[model samples]
Target chain A: MSAVLTLDHVKKVIGGKTIINGLSFSVREGEVFGFLGPNGAGKTTTIRMIVGLMDISEGDIVICGKSIKNDFTGAIKEIGAIVENPEMYKFLTGYQNLLQYARMHDGITKEKIREVIELVGLTDRIHDKVKKYSLGMRQRLGLAQCLLHDPKLLILDEPTNGLDPAGIREIRDHLRMLTRERGMSVIVSSHLLSEMELMCDRIAIIQNGELIDVQTINEFTEQATAAFAFETGSLGDAATWLKSDWNALMMEEGFSVEITREQVPVLIKKLTAEGIDLYGVKAVAKTLEDRFLEVTTK
Target chain B: MGKLIINECAKLFRRTGTWVMFAIVIIMILGIGAFLKYGEVNNPPQVNPAWEQELAMQLEADRAALEETGQNNATLRMFYEREIAVKEYQLEKDLAPETGVTLWSLMSEAQAVIGIIGVFTIIIAAGMVASEFSWGTVKLLLIRPIKRSKILLSKYLTVLLFGGLMLTVLYTVSALVGLVLFGMPEQARPYLAFADGEVVERSMFIQLIYNYLLSSIDVLMLATMAFMISAVFRNSSLAIGLSLFLMFMGGTGTMLLASKFDWAKYVLFANTNLTVYFDGVPPVEGMTLAFSIIMLLIYFVVFHLLAFFVFAKRDVAA
Candidate 1:
């Protein structure tokens, strides 16, 4: 698939300090690309640069094949973003806010406004002043605003920063639906690895202003060594034999060995040939959180 | 660009503070009118029917003094000659001498509302850009499909529009109240001025419009100053505080300096009041309307340059 956004050697230097050092990434069309990083890892900074809120020190960002430096208006017209908090005018109603945003773009009809409001499930409170709305409702209103222009790319920096679990789930599901139905690419940044794993098709991990790795969630989790636990009679004997032969370790109720999926049957046959009556063997899968910690800590 | 300006205006009108400021302006105008009416009702001034006799006496006394002094000073000679011309014209027209309040006089008095308008405009101008940063709404505004220059220009245009709106409200309210209290005059009068060693007469309506425009010069400059501060600092309180303080004290401070130093004529405050060139001499000798206009233009360009350059270049990290 073609990329909706591309960062070519993007660098950010503020006050003589390199905040983002030679970062490069591409978000493909119709995919939820997750940006995983700890606090102060240049996630918000990168998002800001992508949205043209801050200047890119030494590189260019191209949105839908238009360079931001060469054609800012042309490039930015294809993007809808909420950098940091989705701050809006609290004095105006959500509908008025949407109207104000609608004026910035051409050909946004009243029917489109109603459709976005309904899509975000804010049709009931869309007429109320934004100051009176809850944070989740504000986020929904922000989403409605981003959708008003029908942008090709949506960049949300920490979209679920202060949301409850239910709100987070709703945002995640809404983003998934948009990606699936509208075929619009989304770049979302978060520190929550579990949510990223569940929400994103692919994830990019960054640490200390450097891109550590970028891969599919399945590849990130399953590419690690597989651990298999074998529950059998004579657990101590099996543990010793497997430890010498396959470098096994003792588990709670069985002896565990680290091997590939293809070698599991061979290991099981070896254990049985040693006259160890095996009860069952199961492979232990590494969760995204575990892989995230392992990658970040390394 | 048009849509951005409209959006900015819509946001401006949506704020409660903008409406409150408008109400304050209207109430202040009404309050001034009522106070003047009350004063006139409670303490009526005695008008002398034989004011011609009084004028003859004063003119003779001024002539005797000029003779006694030998009319050595040019300024004093000009002053006496202008006073004599005014008194002679009033006696010739058989007009009452400063008798009762007229609609024109009330409208002239209502010009004091310009100062109040200046305060309100300064408040709006100071908060125009800074409040966006404080409210965190700048992010939403800058992420739009338009350029930053268009965004900032649209905001500044909206501020000027609000100032114009307030000025219109002040003039309309004052005119309406004056009409109700002091009926319209049967004839339009001419304003007399001492120019080129003789008395000159000009149309009063033209003079009134000129007065309004001239009086608004200081206000426009100060509002622009406040706007520049708001854009550069992005702190509404600082912009308002500094601009308001300068608006109130700038003229007085420049006057004090003008008395002591000739270089004070070059200062912004000394050149802001373009009205002085019309009716009276500038605070400093040798200062003319063209010079002040040039000075104002320089400051105007400089302030806008700084505002636009800083707003466009500075990173919106917050």
Candidate 2:
């Protein structure tokens, strides 16, 4: 897939201090790209630079084949973003807030606004003042605002910050649908590792304002060696031989061993040939959180 | 651009404070109208049959005051000279001052309400850019397809429009109230204006309208100053406080300085009342219309430069 957004050595300097240093990344079209970073690692700073909320001190950012610096209007026209929080005018109704944003862009009809409000499931309370809205409702309103003009890219920073489980799931499903069915690109930055694992196809991990790794979700979690716990009736007389052959360790009910997948069948056949009682074998998978901690700690 | 302006206006007019401001302007005009009408009913203005002799005595006293004005105090000397010239013209033309308050005269007095409008506009202007930051909306606002300068320009233009509306309301409602309370003058008398040592005739209606606009110069400058500070500092309270302080005290302070220092003519407040120059008095000697206009233009350009520069370049971390 072609890159929908590109950041080339993008840097942000404030008061002679570099906040974001030489960050380079590209987000592909029709992919939910996740940005994972520790607090104070400059994730929001990078996002702000992308959306022109912060000036880029060095390098260039291009969106949809247009440079943001030379052609800001052309580049920004393709993006819909919510930075940090969905801060809206509390005095205006949710619908009026959406209408305010809809007017900023071209060719957004009231009917289109209705469609977006429906998509975000804010149809019932869209006309209520935003001050009365709960955080979740404001989030839905923010999403509705983002989708009004049908932008090519959606950039949401901490989109699930205030959402409950159901709301986060609903947003994840929506992001998946938009990317898969409509070929739209999404850039999501969140501290929720498990959610990012479920929601993103790929994630970029940054630390100290530097890009550390960018890999698919599966690649990230699958690279570490797994421990397989074989639940059986004690190993019988074969316990000593099993320790010698497989380097097994004793457990309360079963023996746990670290091995590759291909060796599992061989070991199982040998155990059965020895007439050892075998009940179950399971691989304790390494979760994304485990891998994320492993990667970030390094 | 039009849509942006509409959005700004929508944000402004939707707030309760905005409507409250308009209501205050109207209620003030009516309140003063009622008070003046009460005074007129209770104690009528006495029309003296020897008004001509009274005018001559006043003119003579003005001449004495002019003589007492020291050679160094040119501003005071100019004030008395203009007074003497206008009174002399009234005496020679056999024109008598209207003893009773006329609608035009009441409206002129009611023009003090424009200062209230200036305060209201300053409040609006101070909050225009600063509130977005406080509300955490500037981050979303700046990420649009439009440029930052355009947004700031649209907001400043909205301030101008709001100020103009307030001025228009002050003028119109005051006229309306004055019409109800004080009837039109017995005969339409031209306003006597002393200019260049000659008293000139100007239609009272047109002259009042002209004064209404010219008097707004100070207000426009203060509003602009408030807007600039708000944009540069992103602090509404500071913007409001600083601008309001200047609005109330700047003119008097500048006039006091202008009495002592020739350099005070270059100050903002000294030139703000360009209407004074039209009425044949300069805050400082040798201050001309062309020179004041150029100074105002310089200040206007400088304020805009500082506002737009800081606003366009600052990061929207909020």
Residue B98's lDDT in candidate 2: 82
Clash tally, candidates in order: 0, 0
Could you give the CAPRI-style class of model 1? medium
Compute the interface RMSD for each candidate structure. Answer: 0.9, 0.8
lDDT of 2 by residue, A236-292 (tens): 788898788889988877798879999999889988898878899999877888888
lDDT of 2 by residue, B17-78 (tens): 99999999999988888888888889899978998999999998988888887366776777
Cα RMSD (angstroms) for every candidate in the order listed: 3.4, 3.0
TM-score of 1: 0.90
Q: Tens digits of per-residue lDDT for model 1 on B165-184? A: 88778777788888898777
State the lDDT at A91 in candidate 2: 98
Which residue pairs of candidate 2 clash?
none
Relative to the unseen true structure, what is the Cα RMSD of model 2?
Answer: 3.0
Model 1, span A1-298: residue lDDT tens: 9999999999999999999998998999999999998889989888888888889999889999998878888998899888878898988999999999999888999999999999999988888999999998888888898999889999888888788999999999999998999999999998887888888989888888889998998888877887788887766456666678889887777777889999988987777777877889888877787788889998
Model 2 CA lDDT for position B242: 100
